[model samples]
Target: MTEPKNLEVCGSVMDGIAEKGSALESPSKKQPTEYTVYPVRWVVLFIFVLYSASNSLQWIQYSIIQDAVVKYYGVSSIVVYWTSMVYMITYIPLIFPASWLLDKAGLRVTTIIGAFGTCAGSWLKVFSVPQDMFWLGFTGQTVVAIAQVFILNVPPRLAAVWFGADQVSSACSVGVFGNQLGVAVGFFLPPMLVRAQGTIEEIGADFQLMFYIVAAFTSVLFVLILLFFKAAPPTPPSAAADLGSNLDSNFLQSIKKLLTNRNYVLLLISYGLNVGVFYAISTLLNQLVLTYYPGANEDAGRIGLVIVVAGMTGSVVCGLILDKTHRFKETTLAVYAASVVGMIIFTFTLDCGIIAVVYLSSILLGFFMTGYLPVGFEFASEVTYPEPEGTTSGILNAVVQIFGIVLTLTYEWMLSNISDRWSNLTLCAILALGTVITACIRSDLRRQAAQNKG
Candidate 1:
């Protein structure tokens, strides 16, 4: 058995991090080292994808059927809405602890926390649903949301550890794909399962059944992860990944270094803007649709499903392009620009009195908006190289959660007080700013540069 060793590194990438135009110095020359891409990496990635999806499904589960949840539970709309809001609320504070745990305990332990939380929460919801205990269900939702703080930070670190440089971005995209797919399920499945027009007893039974199914699936996954998930591969997959293992794992130190990096700071703001708006739209989609076209809660869920599906396609396409071109800045900017354009078109067309057009517009809005997620993750990893991916990625997730809470509340408030047109138009303006910020990012492909060294 041989130990994994980091070969010679390009010290220049670390030196030029905070300074623009000051990092062109070639990697200190060193002999190339052979790295292997293990077949088991795919198995690990598949398991991670499943894990991510399981947790993300809960995020929009209540939001997609907000009206029904309120009716069945005899609760206020806000209480029903809190089922989804809790994810952002809990993630904001817990991501730091989750990241520290990832740094110290590794992926297997993190997966356990996520899986167990999800399983326990699902069972708790099942227990609460029969009696119409809204508070208990909310507690269950809170527990699962805490699990997400751990789940969301896994992709970049997992990709860096298990994939070669050529495939890392695509691998990251696939990891995020499960989460988007799970959201897609949440959007559609509830509508099919729990009929809003049914009697209260019937709907409550439906809710109980839904929770039981989720609990069964999560319990099985918890067992699978316990049996199979490994912390790391036997050897490194690429030079950058090899060196990344040696990067500083100190939580505060990683945060300090990432904050000082100019490009990463810009990305943090831009990513927050992009994701925060997505959260707001997702949270209020049912209401937004109902405002214009009454009795269209199901349509809202389907439209959200369409958006997530399109975004899943966009993520893979963009990931392949990044792998081929190594053009993180261009891809991110293009996606951000498309998201702006999509939002503008969606804002005006949503009230066109045609559901078909609304669905079409949702595809466009979702394709770029959702697609931008993994791109932002990969880009952050690139710009903040040598910073432990777990720590750096944790900060990114935390900022987005903060923004998600603020933007979700703000947009929902505007919808209640003002008009839909103004609220959406406001989002368009914020997205445009994010696009410009994406354009201004100094293309410091530090991680990629490290891989291409002599």
Candidate 2:
């Protein structure tokens, strides 16, 4: 019966009068309008999926066809591995500037440039199709890796801009799923495209065809993005859209704010460890599988396919759960714990010579490992709200790259100098450490929810 709290707080008589007029307006005039949902946003997301897939396709291209690549190029296994490592290496130095571009220029301009880089890199690989052009392939990979710096950091930003609050995490899962799907396809397709065993000339010819096929696909996606992708919706789709104080902050100010956020910093460390380990394992998956089960060397692609499929499915499911419950901290910790168990089981079964056990363990490992990605990205955005999503995600990815480089190099050394079992056990230890860190995180979302209720 008394004045509503919000109306009582009005500071001026004029403001109170305006509030009363609005509150007492005719019922017909005051009727709430139905919020119109745009379908064009999905079209834009599909284009982004293609762009994300193209960026990742090039990353594992050589790794999937490792033996043939080493033979055709006459390089050592170490050199062959660097073709993939270059992607992580390039990201570390470039992510900050890339984040600045995303925040300053907006998503459309950033993604268009990223698409062009992807197309250019794909075509550049075609020139390296000759048996003598290994260096050229590496050069092309460098360019593509740079393109990845732009595209990979945009998913959280994309979700924040296009999706409603209830749907942000699910939307982000789809974007992350696209990259993982690309890696899955990369693993499955290359083995079939390039023969298991081949003469240098034959291998070169097969690789030439493969490059052309990928480049053509990337070119089509680039055209699509240029023509249709919009930076954001015509109207804001979520309350968070109005909360971006950091968007107008200069590059240094944005960086400083993110670094000072306790929740964001903790997530950066924990998330970096999880993803860095994934990158290292993904790059070295062929070597690990072949070492443990020599007979299954030809089946590496199948192993990768199973792992990725399980991970991609888990990502979507986890995303849905987060959206429904907003239990960011609990969800992340559970997956990290499950992943450690999965990896421990996988490590023990690796050389047991039971092929079925190995495959099951691989799928479990993939499901838990890959599923955590979207949750981590979304959690970081929540804690760092109003800070540009691009900056936060970019920093997380850059840290992951740094960890990936170190872990990859360390694993490579361990495989050469120690037993495969010991190397994997060390990784299990790292995963356990990540889980501990994840458990300690205090969810900023929980605090915000409490405030809203009050």
Best model number under TM-score: 1
lDDT values of the candidates? 0.82, 0.77
lDDT of 2 by residue, 1-454 (tens): 1111121110000000000011122323333222123677788888898889988978888987787787788889888888889999999999999998887777898999998998998889999987778888889888988999988888887876666555667888899988998888888788878875777677778898899999999999998998999876554443234333212456788789989988878888889888888887888888888876764545788888888889999999998888777777888899999989988998899898877888899999999998888888878876765567788889999988899989999988998899889998999999999998887888776323421322
Q: Give the lDDT of residue 308 in candidate 1.
A: 97
Model 2 clash pairs are none
Q: What does candidate 1 score on TM?
A: 0.93
Candidate 1: residue pairs that collide: none
Worst 10 residues of 2 by lDDT: 10-19
Task: Show where candidate 1 strays beyond 4 Å.
Answer: 1-32
Number of the predicted model whose lDDT against the real structure is largest:
1
In the order shown, the candidates' Cα RMSDs to the true structure are: 5.1, 7.4
Runs with alpha carbons beyond 4 Å of true place in candidate 2: 1-36, 245-247, 446-454
How many residue pairs collide in each prediction?
0, 0
